[model samples]
Target: MTELTIVANIHAKPDQTGLVKTELLKLIPVTRKEPGCLRYDLHLDNDDPAHFMFYETWESRGLWQDHINAPHLADYKAATEGAIAEFTLSEMSLIG
Candidate 1:
């Protein structure tokens, strides 16, 4: 199966950027250890502190789906509910 690449953009409310960033940071350690996770990286926009992005690669879509439903992910959602102003995710293929 082809690997899955995920690009997730998260925009936090102006007043909630700190909260969102902290919660996002908490996911890194655990997610990196999950099965099938090839790479999981987080980036912050230089011009916009409230804009964050995650670039992830998994062995397969099935494994990525499993990661999506993880308990920690749920916790993140719960914690950042009203703090997020916008969220966008894209699934892509890596074609050399």
Candidate 2:
């Protein structure tokens, strides 16, 4: 099966950029160890520190769903509540 790709765009509140970044970065280490996780990378926009993105690849959509239901992910969401101004997630399929 083809890899399951996801792009998550995150925007932090003006004053909470640093905290948002911190929380997002913390997920990298743990997420990379999860089953079926092929890649989990976090990126920051050079022009806008408040803007962040995650590029991820999973073995399958079901595995990706498992990642979403993880306790750490839920904790991250709860911890970053109100700090994130916007979040957009795109599930992508390789075209080529």
Candidate 3:
């Protein structure tokens, strides 16, 4: 299994931050139900609401790919369109 962790620092549009955050929060349940999805969590920076992080874990790369193709995920990307400034995704392998 390949573990993945994505830290997306989203610079949301001012005032629109709440909307974007709501949209981001919607992904949690959707992602958790996906095949091979171990965990899917969303967090907002206490000091900087514009900054958001998504910590996700999957069973494998293929499963992760499946998540990207999910309709809900697609909708999420579309819904959050102009509200986001940038998103950086990082994949990680857990060792312990």
Candidate 4:
């Protein structure tokens, strides 16, 4: 099976950018330790202070599903509830 990739974009409420980023960053270390996580990286938009994105790779779709339901992810969602203005997630398969 090929690895599963995810590109997630997050746009935070103007005033909550810093707080949202703090919560997002906390997920990195924990997510990296999960069973099927191949890569989990966070990036902040250079020109847009309130924009952030995550680039992730997983060993399989099943493992990625497990990750979505993980406790840490729930915590992150709860913590940033209304602080985020927009959130988009794209699932992709590598071409080569």
Best candidate, TM-score-wise?
Answer: 1
Worst 10 residues of 4 by lDDT: 1-10
Best by lDDT: 1
TM-score of model 1 relative to the true fold?
A: 0.99
lDDT of 1 at 65: 97
**1-96, model 3: which lDDT tens digit per residue?**
557655456778777788898888898887888888888878788898788888877888888888889999899889988888777888878877
Q: Estimate each model's TM-score.
A: 0.99, 0.97, 0.89, 0.98
Q: Which should have the higher lDDT, number 2 or number 4?
A: 4
Q: What is the lDDT of every predicted structure here?
A: 0.99, 0.95, 0.81, 0.97
Candidate 3 deviant stretches above 4 angstroms? none
Per-residue lDDT for 6-96 in model 1, tens only? Answer: 9999999999999999999999999999999999999999999999999999999999999999999999999999999999999999999
List, residue by residue over 1-96, the lDDT tens digit for candidate 4. Answer: 789999999999999999999999999999999999999999999999999999999999999999999999999999999999999999999998
Clashing pairs in 3: none
Model 1 worst lDDT run, 10 consecutive residues: 1-10
Q: List the candidates ranked by lDDT, beginning with the highest.
A: 1, 4, 2, 3
RMSD to the true structure for each prediction, in A, is 0.4, 0.7, 1.4, 0.6
Candidate 4: pairs in clash: none
Output the better candidate (3/4) by TM-score: 4
Comparing 1 and 3 on TM-score, the stronger one: 1
The lDDT, on a scale of 0 to 1, for candidate 3 is 0.81
Each prediction's total of clashing residue pairs, residues at least 3 apart in sequence or on different chains, is 0, 0, 0, 0
